[model samples]
Structure formats: C-alpha cells, structure tokens
Target chain A: MYTTWWPPITLSHSRRDQLLRALLWSCASVAGLMLVCIVAFLILESAPALSHPGWRRFFTDAAWHPTEDAYALWPMLAGTLLSTGGAVLLAAPLGIGTAVFCQWYAPAWLAVPCRRLIELLAGIPSVVFGFWGLVALVPLINQWQPPGASLLAGICILTMMILPTTSLLAQASLAQADPDALRAAAALGFGRWGTLRRVVLPSCAAGLLTAGLLAASRALGETMAVLMVCGNVVQLPSSLFDPVRTLTANMALEIPYAAGRHRSVLFVSGLLLLLLVISLVGSATWVRRALRHV
Target chain B: MNAGRAWIPLLLVLAATAGCGDSPDARQPLTKLSITGSSTMAPLIAAIGKRFERRHPGVRIDVQTGGSSRGVADTRSGLAHIGMVSRALRALEQRDLVGTPVARDGIGLIVHNTNPVGALTPRQVVALYTGGMTTWRPVSGKDASVVVVNKAEGRATLELFLKYFHLTNAEIRADVIIGDNEQGIKFVAGNPHAIGYVSNGAAEYALRHEVPIKRLPLTTASAPPAAGHPAPSPLARPLTLVTTRRPPALAQAFIAFAASSHVHDLVAAHYFVPLAA
Candidate 1:
C-alpha cells in the first residue's frame, strides 16, 4: 500500500497515525472534561442544600419555602413527571404511526414532502411555540374550559413540539430495517401488512423506544412553552386541566432572584434534572441491550 | 515535551477562570463608570445615566442588568463602580456594603375589574394565597373558584409580597406564575377570577391604560404593622444604590445624582414615589 501511494513530503505512516490518534484523544477528553466539570460544579453548588435538607427530605417533603428554610421539591418533581409523561403518551403513538405511514403507505411524492414538513416544524424555535401557545392555544383552551391555561395546554404544545423529532427518528429506524428479511417475508407469501407487523417492527422496537425516550427528554427539559401555558402552579396536578410547574420552569423563573441557600437549592433542582435525564437515557440503552439479547 | 503539553491546558483553564478581574489597562485616565444589577432598577438607572452623561460630556456611564444579587456581587468584586439594587440590603450584605436609598415603590394586590370584590383583609389575602380559601364565594360572595396568579421566583415583587404577607416562597398556592409586572397584570386582565400582585407604578400604568384590573388596598387594621423599618408601610420598599466600600468620587457623584431632586421627575415618571419630594 505504501509502495503504490507514498507522498513525496509526508511523515511516516506510523507517525501520521500516532498524531491523528493523539489529536482525536485530546478532543474527546476535552469534551468529556466539560461534562465532568458541569456535573461537578452543579453538585458542588448544590452541596449545602443536599446536606441541610438531606436527600430524603429534598425528595419527600412537598413544601419548597426557601426563604423560610423549608426545601421540599416534591411538587415541582411531580409536575415534571406528569407533563413529560403526558406529552410522551400523546406524541409517541402519533409519531410512530406517521413514521409507519411514511415508510410503507405514503407514495414517494407524499413521503418526501411529509418528511421535509416535519423537519421544518422541528426548525421553528421553541420560544415561538411558547408565544403561539400563549396567544392562541391558551385562550382557546380557556374558552372551552374555564381558565384555559393549563397542564392540558402544556401537554398539547409539547406533543406538537416533540412530534417532529420522534417521527423523524422513527422513520430513520424503520428505513434501516433489514431488506433481506422483508424480501424473505414476501417470498414466503406474507402480505405487506403481515410482513411489516411480523418482521419489520420487532427489529425496530429498540429504535422506536429510543425515539420515544428522546421525545420524552425534550418534553422534560422544555421550559418556555410549558412555562407560558402550564400556569406555573406548584402543586401535584389532580387533572390535566389543573395548572402545574415543571422543574425547568421553576429554575428559569427563579434563578435570577435566588441567593444563599435558596440559590443552592435551585442548583440541587438542576442536579436532580440531570440525574433524571441520565437515568432515562441509561434505561433506554439497557432496554436496547435487553432487546438485542432477546 | 510531555510535561509542557500537560501544563498548556492547566494554564488555559487558570487563565479563563481568572480572566474576569480587571486589568491595569482598565484603570485608564478616562472618566468611565460601570453600574450593574437589579433589572427593575435598570431602566431608572439608564435614564439617570443618560442625563448624567449629558451633564458631564467627557464622562461615560455604562449600565447593565441581571438582578439585585448580581449588583451586590459586582460591587463587592469591584466589577462595577456602583450596583443598583431595588430591594433593601440584607444584614450579611450590609456588612461589606453601604446602601443609599434612591426611591420607594409599593407592591399592590390586583384583581380584574369584573370581579366585585373591592378590598381584601391581610388574613384573607394570606388565606387565598395559601390554598386555604379556594373559592371566591366564601370570601368575595362571587360564585367562582379563585385563580391565584403568582410571581415567578427571584422577582423583587414576589419577595416583597412574600415578606409582607409573612409567607414563604413555596407556601403560596398559585394557579399561574408570571415573570414580569406586565405578564401578571395581563393575566389578571384576561381572567376575571385571577388575583395577582405587581409594583404600584405598574399597576397605576395598567389602570391608566384601561387594562380592566383593579388594585385592591389592604385594610389598614388588618395590615401587618410596620416594624424594624424606617417606613412602616408593609408594601413599600426602598430602591438603594450600593457600594462595597466608601464609593469612589465618580460613584458618589452618580449616587448623589440618583438620590437628589434632579431625578425626582424621572423617578416619579417611572412610577416610583420620590423620596425627596
């Protein structure tokens, strides 16, 4: 290989490979260092709250009166779970169904446009979605139900915001399904529906689940749209109609004004969110591994 | 070579962290002042700065906004010549810094004009906020559930409200939490059943603009008696300009300009009650 294509003025192949390896290693380490730094910084800043209220009380007690020294975060935690779970529950099925239609049912002309449209929806800024939700969807909800700005509105907005990503990921996964299996299924005289149901989907279960988890993460981290529509109420919502505040919303809304232990507690909330998202992604990986083994 | 390479990143991180401190070049002969902090005070400071700048042609005044804490931090660290804080300084902060009150503002409870209730006792207000009183029927004689609008965390308005009512930040059961005065007022304007609070200046402006919300006065008898304060008004607080040490000459001048009768019209124009007047 060297005899065929040695450059006149270049380092030895071994030296070149070593240099490239070093460069890549440094770049990767820098990125990993940044992640470690962020997590460490959050933990350091939140240490006071963690030690004072202690983790159990931080997780268990519902009241969050930082000024008065009570630091329970249960209400915001519940809000985060409820809204994100609601969004995922609504968006996942619709997103996967759209992907299926695009993969199998939609003609080429329709499919391309549909995918492009979904990408366009994804491109619109979250703040614009928040504004639209605030100005239009909120009032409409209010008219339908008294005091319309609610968890239901937040869920609806989040579903629309997250749908594009979920569907696009699902489509990519479905497209990557084995052609050999599809052809074999057809050869076995299985119809399109039977082949899709029996062969294509099971192989794509991990991918579809990943898409759902990614969508759920987006929903969980969402601040602006939910903040605008969710009413930012600090309560365990009894119904979708009830207003609720997510952790992200609480942080964004209060970070500027918070100081002392109150400030540390907010950082603790950040650590909680980081831990929650990491575990969620970890579970997705675990599920994928379990599926592959099966 | 290997040791030198390892030292490079360590040096870079050190440099980045230490970069914020002022360099010798920053203390040039030019008469420049940088003021940062409380977003609520930012507008007022900006206005005064413009007038001060015009009065002293060669002098430049730079203003920035984060929050009152940023103001205190900036002042303590010498990042700014002066910090603009809307709220009174805490005991810890007062140790290292001196605050000169510039203006006063009151937080007022507001409700939609469509609601028949004109006034709420302090106890009723606390009860309504704490989720104890859920419906308007028991308190206001209106057959509607109370939609308690609240301030987002970190707002001076929210802090002031909480302190006045003898409540903590978390205890208030809010239906909607809004960021700024305009958002709070707009929420109340839109929903007849909603109740919220904002600075008196903002409330007055909203009322003048016919936003369809009314400011409810706390009955004087039930209002928390003024204690350990120069002005015993439960709802009123001073907007203070702070400095870490004895302020520099330029900072002192700026503080004077902000406090004096020169900016009285400007302060009143922004809805603050002028201290001198």
Candidate 2:
C-alpha cells in the first residue's frame, strides 16, 4: 500500500526529517548572521572615519593623535604583527620539538603526563598568566634591564600562552602520519633518524604549518596578558627592549574614554584589526589548500 | 509515538530558551540604595554607608568602584541611584544630571623618593611629559631615560593632568599606562626614574604609609584656574555626587548625610581635603 500523497495533519517520516533539517539550518544561519551583523555594524560605524579626508592618512601616517585629528595606525598595526610574529617564532620551534618528542621519542609512561601537562597549561586562565608575568616575569626582566615591561616581555608571555595550542595541534597531526611508513622505512635499512626525516616529517609538514598559523591567530587576538606586559606605549619599537602598544591594548585602554572623532577612529582601528585577522586566517587556509594540492 | 518523540526535542529547544527568565521576586525587606563609580570615592562612600546603615536599620547602602565615567553612565541608565564622580562635569555632560560637590581632591605628580625633584615649573612639566626631555637630568639630575608613566584614558586624574598641562592625552609619550591612582603610585614607587600623576589624597596616604613615592608641587603660582584649581600648588578638583533625576526620599537623605559638615572628619580620614567651612 503506497500512499504517495503528503500527510497534512500528521508528521510523516520524510516531513519530520525535513523539519529537523530546517531547524538545524536555522541554528547554523543564526551563527552566520551574527558574524555578518558584526562585520556590517563595524563597517557602518567606521564609515564616517573611512570617508574622512584623513582616512587615507590612517595607513600612511605614523603619528596617532586622535584629539588633533591625526588618526594613524602604523605603530599599533606593527606592534600587533611584531608581537604575534615574535610569539610564533619562539613557540613554533619549541612546540614542534615537543610534538616530535611526544610522538616518537617519549617513553610510553611519560607521553600521557607530558600531553596532560600541556593541556593543563592551556586550561590556566590568561589573567592568572598575566599576574604571574606581572609579579614574577616583570621583576626578572627588570633585574636584567631597566624598563622591564617591553616588547621582549610581551613576546615571552605570549609565547608561553600560545605554546599549548601549537604543540597539541601539531602532536595530533603528527599522530596521523602512517605508522606503516615508519615500519617500511625501518625495513629498508634506514635508521630511526632517516625514517622520521623521509617518512614521518614530510607527511606532517602541512599540519605543522597549520598549527603555527592557529597559534599565531591566538596570539594576535590576545588582549589582557599583552596589555598587562606591553606597557601600552604608542611608539615604533626600535628594539626588543622598547615598549610598544598593540591594537587590542589600545582599544582596551582607550575605548572607555573615547568620544566623537576619537570614538570613530577607535572603531576604524577595530575594523582594521578585524580585517587583519580575516586575512590572516584566509591566507592560512589558502596555504593549507595549496599544500594539500602539492 | 512519533508525535510524542518529536515533541521532546521541540520542548527542549523551548526550555533552553525560556530557562533564563527570572524567578518571581521574593519580597526584599531592605531599602536598597546603590552607589557606584569613582574608585577614589569608594573608601569614603563605604565608610559613610556603614554609619548610614546603622542609623537606619532597614536601609542597605551598596557601594561599588569603577571609574567616574561608569558612575555617570550608570546613573544616566538608572542602574545606580547615585554616582560618585571625582571631576567636574564637562559642559556637555552637565545636561540631564545634578551634581553635588562632596569633597575636594588635588592631582599631584609623583616620583620615586630616590629622585631629588622638588617642584617642576609648569613649562618643565609639560616638556618632560611631551618627550622633549627624556632624561631626569633636567628635572632631578639622574642620567637615565625619564620613564613617563601616564594614566589610561577616562580616569579623572588623567583628565585633570592633561587639562592642567594644556596637552592632549596623545601628546604625552608614556612608558606605562596605569589604570588607577594606586597603580600609578605603585609604578612610580617601583622605578627609580618614573614620574606619574595621581590624586593628592591617594599619594599622600601612600607617602604617609612609607611608600617610597613623593608628590611634586606645581611651581607656577597663578597658573590659570582652567588648568585645575587656583590653589597655588596642588591641582585641585572636586569629588561630586550625581543623580539623573530628583532621587527618592531615602536617597535624598543619604545625599544630605554624605554632604553634611559631620562627615568632615570622615573626609579627612580618607586623605581627601575637607570642603571649606
């Protein structure tokens, strides 16, 4: 008995499936809509500054004097890049090394504790880390140098913060490399070193790169710890010792007090940061895709 | 069976959305008066609140500390019954609120006790903050980079300092951007060459407590009143109580209690200058 007609009163199996699909679609759409609304709102709010005469000057000029209408973002933009880049540079090697050690070198009993330790490190709140950096690391730096809160201190703190993400992800990806390949390499009169280099390392290169990019993104978005350590100076950092202010730190420190044109300028800088992050993630995905094709 | 099973998920979705709604109020017996804003005014307000609560047994006074702007915003939004502000209302902010001067405070520059800087001419102070002079040699005769510590934006002390110096916040090249008076004092206290400004009351309290920080006086007598107060030395600003509308009877009583001459000892105890009799 094939009843092809639709059930109007009762929910048929297909109709129920359709309803569930629609509900899931609505949930997903809500998330997507939130992101769209945020981007649209930021752009709309920032349009006045974007359309101003000094708008182009924002990218070119280095002096960020909002009261005098000099709305430059070079220093902060550079600071964000330098700090994130420094963190990635320090964390990547350490993270990859730890990942490699855990995957291939560590004994069976040691591996679980090592991974657990890294996860615990990740679980610690950022403010706690910032406090430690303030009470512990700042004085340590001060003992070595005069002005303790500087770019180096920021880099060091951010490096510690991002390490768990980089290493954990890299470790997961490294685990996916074919165990058979290692066995095959061993069978071919290759040493353990040779097996890791030729068989294991090449297979996980893209994953390692992805981990680095993800860690970099995390470092880029960090606010409190960097704000606490970076000293919030609005200057082009000439050396690692010089204090610098990031876009996030600037927003956190100034947005409370900003009004009028100053307010517009801060919103525009936020838009700029949003764009920078999008481009960073975009490029990372593009690279990952390109690497997959290769 | 199918309809009943389907209702479970639908009911869950509804429940999740509806779960956050408030439970019906249990009758609150206490007459609550919320006071928020101005960390500078927090201790004074807290002390006064205690005595007020003792006098009126059923009344509760809630004191909170954020910046002065939070006070203004909270009062405007009706989130707070009264706001404590440490600076005079700007011309634009004067609308829609009534301000009562409760106490006086002065903005003073603090330096490490190791630094021998006694007083700065208004010109020298401006020059130092603007990064025109980097070393302490001109101000205190130390061969080190002058670590100019400035306040984060929107603080009353920062606003007063900027106005007094005839400088915008951006013009100053600060090595550190501290959040509050205590933080500014701490930064200056820790570093040998650091100079930062905070409320005179806070600095005085810290100094008296043997904190290794000293308040610097402004040497320019007859410096314009627009800069701060014409007090001839310390830059004086008022700590105010603000309300968006005529407060409720209880709130008005609290206001009168806070403003009366009886609180003079309380004001002086908190290290703020008592209002002239």
Candidate 3:
C-alpha cells in the first residue's frame, strides 16, 4: 500500500522535505514575530499619551486639538464605529442576499457573471472608490444636503467597498452547505425559498456571521476611501449629513506632519483601532465556536 | 526535489549579484547630498537640485519631504546635508541651525471662484474661523452656510495661518480638516460655499491651471487697497534652507546655487517669489 505511488524515499528527498518544512516554519514564525513586534512598537510609541496626567481628557474632551493639549479620542472613535456599523448594517444583508440569489435562484450564466462582477468590485483599489466618491457621489449627495462629505458619504463608500468581501465570503459559505440536506429538502417537497430558509441559511450561520464580522473589520480599518469621502472633521456627527472623521483617517492625515507628543497621540489612535479590530475578530471566533457547539 | 534544489542556488546567486552593483568604488567617489523637510518647499528645492546635478556629474541630490520640524531636526542631527523650511527659523530653531532665505511665500484665504465675497478683514476672517460668522451672507456672499476648512496640526501652513490670524488651533470651528495646501485648494475649488487658507504660491499655481479657486486679499482696518490694486499679502514668510552651523563645502555650494539668480527662474516656476538680488 505504501509503495504503490510513493516516490522512492531517498536521502536527498527526505533532506529536501525537511528543508521545505524548515522554510515554511521560519516564514510562519517570522509573520508571527512581526505582529508581536508591531504590537510592542505601538505600545511603546503610545506610552507617552497613555501615561499623560490628563489622559482622561481623551474620553471626555469635545474636540481633538492636540496642539492645544486636547487629546479627545471619542469623536474619532465614534466616527470609526458609526461609519463601519452603518456600512455593515447596509452591506451585510444585501451581500448575503446577492449570494443566495446567485447560488440558488439565478441561471448559470448570470450567476457566473454576477459572481465575477462582485469579485471584480473587491479588486478595484480603495483609492479609485475614494476618487469616484469624491468626484461623483459627494456632489450627488450635496444636491440633497448642503455638505456632501459626511458620515453618510463615508458609509456609502464603505458599503460599496466592503460588499465584495461580504458577498464573496457568503457565496463560499453557501457553497459549503450539504448537498444531501438540499436533496432531502427537495425530496420532502420543499420549494427553493423554503429549503433556503430552513436548511441553507441555518447550516451557513457561522460563515455568514464570520463574513459580516470580517467586512466590519475591513470597514473599520479602511483609510483612503473613508478619508476622501468623510469630511474628516474631528467631531461626533449630529446627523448623517454632518461630516465626521475616523481614527484611521485621523492617523493618516496627521502622521506625515506629526511629531513629539502629537506623533505619540497618533500612535495611540493606531492602538485603539487595533483593539477595535481585535474585539471584532474575537467576537467572530466566539460566535463560530458557539455555532459549532450547537 | 531536483528542481527545488536547483532553484535555491540560482536565487542565492541572483541575490548576490543584486547586492554587488550598489557598492561604490574608491576611484570615482559619488558625493550624495541628502536634503529633507518642508513638503511645501520640496518641489522648488528639487527643481533647483536637478539643475545643480546637471552642472556636477559626480554629485547626487536626494530631496525628501517631511514637515519643517523634521528639517530642523535632521539638519541638527546631521541626517540631512540641507533641510528646506518654508518659514524663517524661530528663535529656538535658529540656536542650533542657520537658515538661508531662498524665496518668499504668502499664506492667504482661498474660496470658490463663484463665491461673491471679495475680501475679508482680519476680524471677519477670525469670526468665520471661530464659528462667529456661520453664513457667507454676513461676508457679502450668497445666502449659504460657509464651510470652514482648517489644516491639521504640525503643518507649517497651519502654524503660519494661526499665527497671522492671532488664533489658536482650539479656536477654529472647522467643518473639514485637510492635510496639505493642495488638498485645501482642491476642497475649496470643489465646494461653492467652502473657504480655506493655503500657500499663496500653491493657490496661484492652481489658478494658472484653471482650478476654480481665488485668493482673497488680506485687509486690515488701518489700510484699504488702492483702486485696482489688491492689498499685498499680509502673511508672507520666507522659504529657507537650513544647515548646521558649519556645513560641508558641497552643502555651501548647493545653498549658494539655491539662493543665487541662476535658480530664480526655478523658484518663480514653482510660484514662489524669488528673493530680490
């Protein structure tokens, strides 16, 4: 049984196998080590701002005037959460629905092309989306509202940018549903809609949740498109039409010119974004684990 | 296994060859000069550097842009042979480094071309920025809410704008916080009711390229513009090159070239006012 298709286990082959394993192990360790180093560096750089006597102001202060010693983080933090939340709320349902449509209902030709188009949407660089939003979407919104670059614009752009991620992941998850279960449902006289509602969706709950969470994280970390479309005012928005700035956008906008304590504060903002993304991923893992248990 | 083993040595050899080309020989010494700081002055300095390089085949001028503070830090730390600062050295900066004026630039308020407001007094400008005047109608423009665009902290233009207006960063009630002069100009040009202040040179260059934004004259109560002639920019600053107290001979030569009449055309081409001979 062992000798039928196996290549002769020569010394050179064994040595090469060991070498490949070693190479892969080193690569994996290097990636892990780099992540640790990045976390350490962020903590070190942000220590100044974190340890400052007036650090409490970061949560309480109304504005982000770092030069004036106001290190308010709430507004930008709120901006990040709100825009990403809005994007996820809008994109998840539409994306999952698109996936369901393509997987079950659409004709083969239409499904293939539609899937490819959504994947294509993922490939278009965020900067292009940002440019389009600025030149096209912002003005369109401005016609109805006074200022175009608002939280609403940011959310719309993020939704477009993250839709591909959610849809593609959902399609993959839908593809993972048991064929036997589908056949059983069909044998029991279940229609497409009934089969989808009772069997397809429940089986793919973990994957759908994972898809939504991944998209949320992507939206949270998005910088260029959000920076361009979001008016980048360091204030909590009073309305959807009001301009807002996110933590990521704030760092990108300031890091080029930031120095001294100002630079440290930007690092703190990075650390905050990292924590937010981690919590999202943690929740995703917890949900997946709970789903597996059930 | 054979193919994998064959590829390893080939990759090693390729990496070795790639590393070998960059090592300099002692015979033909390459004199590399690093110039850093001031994104505002980078284009002008880079243009001058190109002309300087053409004259000396052995020399390379590497121009980098951070902000003006990086210019001072790098010059003092000897990381850069020269640093381009868009403003005159402050008393603190002057203690460790010397700055030579190469050109002049003015910071001025810019608004969309369609905006009817012609000029803003110092008080009116302050009021608009501090949320005192929220609407353009008060400033003689159409009945629309004005969008005040402010620059982020650590920008030289922001510092100059704040200093000239006699306001602090905390005072500004900005609707949009932009990063650079180009961003400010582009933002103003895109929004009919938006007003932003940026480098006069940049705004002039933008106007030449048909970016629909106009610079408003800086007016004060003591003096008004004579008929036909607009008030000269009140927030003018020198664009200077900074070096340590004792710079190398090559650095001195480059500085002289940057300031001399030879590169005045280059300075003017960048829309900065060339220093009078």
Task: Give the chain B TM-score for each candidate.
Answer: 0.82, 0.83, 0.85
Question: Model 1: per-residue lDDT, tens digit, A17-101?
Answer: 6566667789999999999999999999999988887878876765666776667688989889988888899899999999999
Q: Write the per-residue lDDT of candidate 2 for residues A62-145, one digit (tens) a residue.
A: 677776667778888899999999999999999999999988899989988999999999998887787677657765676567
TM-score for each model: 0.85, 0.83, 0.91
lDDT per residue for candidate 3 within A154-264, as digits (tens), equals 999999999999999999999999999999999999999999999999999999999999999999999988988888988879999999999999998898777778889
* Greater-TM-score candidate between 1 and 3: 3
Highest-lDDT candidate: 3
Q: What local distance difference test score does each model get?
A: 0.84, 0.81, 0.87
lDDT of 1 at A18: 59
- For model 2, how does the per-residue alpha-carbon lDDT over B34-55 read when each residue is reduced to its tens digit? 8898889989998989988999
What TM-score results for chain B when candidate 1 is compared with the true chain B? 0.82
* DockQ winner between candidates 2 and 3: 3
* Candidate 3 lDDT over residue span B25-64, tens digit each: 2224448788999888998998999999999898989999
Docking class of 1: acceptable
Compose the digit string of candidate 1's lDDT tens values, residues B152-194. 7677878788878899866787878888787778777777788
Q: Model 1, A247: alpha-carbon shift in Å?
A: 1.9
List pairs with backbone clashes in candidate 3.
none
Query: True interface contacts reproduced by each model, as a fraction?
Result: 0.53, 0.35, 0.52
